[model samples]
Target: MTLYGLVSSFYNQKAAVHAALRDNIDTRTALEELRVLVSQSNAYIAGRKNAKLAPNRMLLQSIALYLTDLLKTFGAIEGAEPIGFPVGTNGQNVDLESTVMPYLKVLSDFREGVRKIAREQKVTEVLSLCDMVRDETLPELGVRLEDHEGLPTVVKLVDRETLLKEKEEKKKMAKLAKMKIPPSEIFRSETDKYSTFDETGFPTHDADGKEISKGQTKKLRKLYEAQEKLYKEYLDSMQNGS
Candidate 1:
């Protein structure tokens, strides 16, 4: 089996076993997480089919390694101690052959089939495969796989685009909010656009700069004037009373 095949199978088996044997553990949740990881791993491979990364084989290898690592972790956690598997065989004692092997074989078959189809078929096929494994096989294996409506996996697949768009939208909304409600200017501009005074006895004509509308400026001035008047009136009343 291919490395990808092996890795996917390893996790798939562990999840299945945990679901079967462990009554106390939330096997359903565990299976769902494993399924999502495998789905994402498969999607990565699908992307690498015609990806343009330099030394692209390294990319695929890296993904395979990541998958292997995840599977190894799962195997360790789930206590995938093999029963009849031979020792000194160099394979992990993680139910590698009996439970994981058949899943690997199925994945290999799917990969070969997809390879035969057009390059565009890669994503569609991988997604379809993920759905199939989650829906059909997980049920048969008595593992409860949650239906996130493919959202979690899609987020992983298109993470950059989605994250960038979300960031930009937040920035745009913040910009709009800033425009609606101005922030206090701590530092003045080098050349104050509103300043009419010119240095070095120069006659610098000023064009009208964009300022707060006349109505807003008037209201602010009125508010400050009212406050000052109220303070003065209060002082006068105190003096008279004294």
Candidate 2:
């Protein structure tokens, strides 16, 4: 039966117990009614053995709530001993604690069983979903997961924004490195003019065999140093963010 049906059946049983108590039934009869209620609860649980996990969870929670109401009802009967037994003929004090203890234990155990199952199911689902994402989704997108202490697995992106920034900084550094050793400004021969390849794959040269002029070289060196400093700053920023 569905959770709702089970809950409805339990509710009807509870109503019968309530009516039995109100009618001043004999202690034995009242006890029997209570026993029937407990049995009904257990039967509901047994019947759900093959049910889906979600419905089972809902059923257990509903049972717990209903059991709370039943406990309150049991508490209200005057001069009734624990387990709903009446005071004895000899006027001996009823063992209220002992009588109630067994029923309370049963209810507590039922609630705890439900809690344990729910917690285990939740953890299993979370771990399974995480595994699927790590194993199936990440690799296809060139992403990786990094495990860390006291933290979730971090997704490592090949083309993340910070990495892209670092790439751009490296490109700037390369330009600066090339600038530090400036090319010759004047070419003396065809060999000098054909020394370096241009964007069009044609050879070009600044100066044939000579190095750059001192003044121009000094200016380029200053620019290269400044660029290098900026690149270092960028690198530090990236490291700090990571």
Cα deviation at 10, candidate 2, in Å, is: 1.8
Best by TM-score: 2
Tens digits of lDDT, candidate 2, 100-213: 546544543453445457567776565555555544554454444534333323344443454545546867777655444323321223353345544533233334644556
- The per-model lDDT (C-alpha) reads 0.46, 0.52
For candidate 1, what's the RMSD?
Answer: 20.4
Compose the digit string of candidate 1's lDDT tens values, residues 1-242.
34466456656756664674466766456656656655765655554433522223553455445545545555533333423222224544344345555565565456445634734565666667765664445444333333332121211112244545555686777654434321222112214433332342221222355444567557645644554565465566568983
TM-score list, all predictions: 0.20, 0.26
RMSD of each: 20.4, 26.8
Please report the candidate that would top lDDT against the real structure: 2
Worst 10 residues of 2 by lDDT: 181-190
Residue clash pairs of candidate 2: 186-207, 187-207, 187-208
